[model samples]
Target: MNRKRCLILGASGGIGEAVVHRVIEDGYAAAVQYFTNEDKIRTIQQGIPEDQWAGSFQADLSTKEGLQAFFRVLPPEWDAVVFAGGHMYSGLFQDMKEEDMDALYYVHVKSLWMTARHVLPYMIQQKQGNIAVVSSIFGTEGASMEVAYSSVKGAQNTFVKGLAQELAPSHIRVNAVAPGLIQTKMNGHLTLEDLQALENDIPMGRAGTPEEVADAVGFLLSRSSRYVTGQILHVNGGWC
Candidate 1:
């Protein structure tokens, strides 16, 4: 490929969609992973120049079969992989269910580990690769009603740090972008009063854009951040 190439997980989501554009804008061809929204993936894929469209894969990511299917479909080599996929649970801890928690674990933590494992052989052989995870500020500071979600985000943050160091000698860079609060469908369930209240708490008094987070991610995946790794770059309007 003339430019760098990448695979981004969760292209159907708001942040994922924005990152796809940003990666392409920075001159990278891409492959996208979608869970149940094949239509959206097709739309995004169609928008890219045919030459820059790598391919698309669909998988649950919360189950072994799905992860295997997804990984099996990946090209033998790519310049980067962005774990831009996640789920959120925003209710009191008492109401959380066992199955839901398991889903959170698999999607946020397990999938990342498995992804790294799947790509390690290729990246190590190439002696270089970039992994940028989409994390959230909730991971840094606990949120009152989102204990489980925050916990998962915290796990992602810690995992990025550990993995970066573990693979640094091989020249593979790992980093994460923790969006403070973003205006996305994930937060669409929030009541107007709740969103406004949350925004008021942010120092900048606004929710961030997915494009902003994507830009930070683009930096991590580019030569610009060659010397940077194992860090959580916050994109949350200074909320945390």
Candidate 2:
């Protein structure tokens, strides 16, 4: 008998890596995708046993050609997908470079929409599938210095809700995990003082962990969440 398989986009990242492990533990073979982090994805692939390793894919989602090639190579029968790819920019909206803005839109908005277009057919045919995107709290409560990031994440949230409604009739579920301040390398730019200040604002007095976020993704992919759809499950520790 064959087990279900899930594709983990941005599997090299902190939350993505945790989700990869979580999906495997939940009895699904896992395929990992990464853009430039070959070493990191390889390390994650190695950690999983061969039976649960569904191979790795490298795709630069910022380009159309890359997206085309990625879909061409993806295995045809993925049981679920977790869009955890992220790109961050922090600056005044006016000062934001066009290239940075383009990258954010491509990664957060365009690629996500395209991934759904590519996979929804298989899911619709099977009459069951799961999609969970890694969104941010800033998506709902806009951030001051991260206007572009917040805008794209807001688009992500909207996409989740809209697509969920459309796919519900097909028995496919779509949801998002909007994380607060997670302790990922993506936040390496923050100094200890910066982290402390941010933590102080959270009611929980701390940031969330990647594993905690992954657990939520796992539940969304599981039969446990059969009735849960079109929801943005906030993993923020009462920070919002």
Candidate 3:
């Protein structure tokens, strides 16, 4: 049997990197997508066997034309699509600038919607596909000092829910993983004290690992989750 092709956006980030490992371990031909961080991308590529590595592309997903160009370079068929790319800006709502809002909208909301719009038609035509979106707990409950980030994530949560229903008839499954407080470069600015304080709040008493979150994603993409759709899986270590 031919191995399925899987596309992972933001493959250079912590969670994205973890997803790439999991996908490759599952025997899929994987493609990593990124807009920047060529060094990290190169490192990830080196870790995978050449036969399983489908190469990388740099595309700024903030524009429609950019997304079109990104997709134009790929093969017409993909068995799975993972929207793992996102951006977060934490600050007082009053301190938020227009550009901040635009950045959040472009990365967290618009890009996912537009990519899904472009990809789903092909999935529908093929009559089989899976889409897993990575969201944050803020998307469900909102977050202080993270107004723009929370809003975009909330939109992503709703998008997954609605898209799951809309695509189910075509034999396409859509789900999301909402992770909380993972130790990624994204949180490098936090002090040890800050990290511990956040961890204490979670019933699990520790920050979730990217690999743990990736495991949730793997489950959603597998046959075990064949009957599941329109659901948001929280990999937050018991945190709300």
Best-fitting candidate, scored by TM-score: 2
Off by over 4 Å in 2: none
Question: Between prediction 1 and prediction 2, which has the larger lDDT?
Answer: 2
TM-score of each: 0.96, 0.98, 0.96
What TM-score would candidate 1 get against the native?
0.96
In model 2, what are the clashing residue pairs, if there are any?
Answer: none
Q: Compared with the true structure, what per-residue lDDT tens digits does model 2 show for residues 126-153?
A: 9999999999999999999999999999
lDDT by residue (tens digit), candidate 1, 145-216: 899989999999999999999889999999999998898999999899999999999999999999999999
Better of 1 and 3 by TM-score: 1
Model 3's C-alpha root-mean-square deviation from the true structure amounts to 1.3
Q: Which scores better on lDDT, 1 or 3?
A: 1
Considering every candidate listed, which one attains the maximal lDDT? 2
Give residue 23's error in model 3 in angstroms. 0.4
Query: What shift in Å separates residue 222 of candidate 3 from its native position after superposition?
Result: 0.3
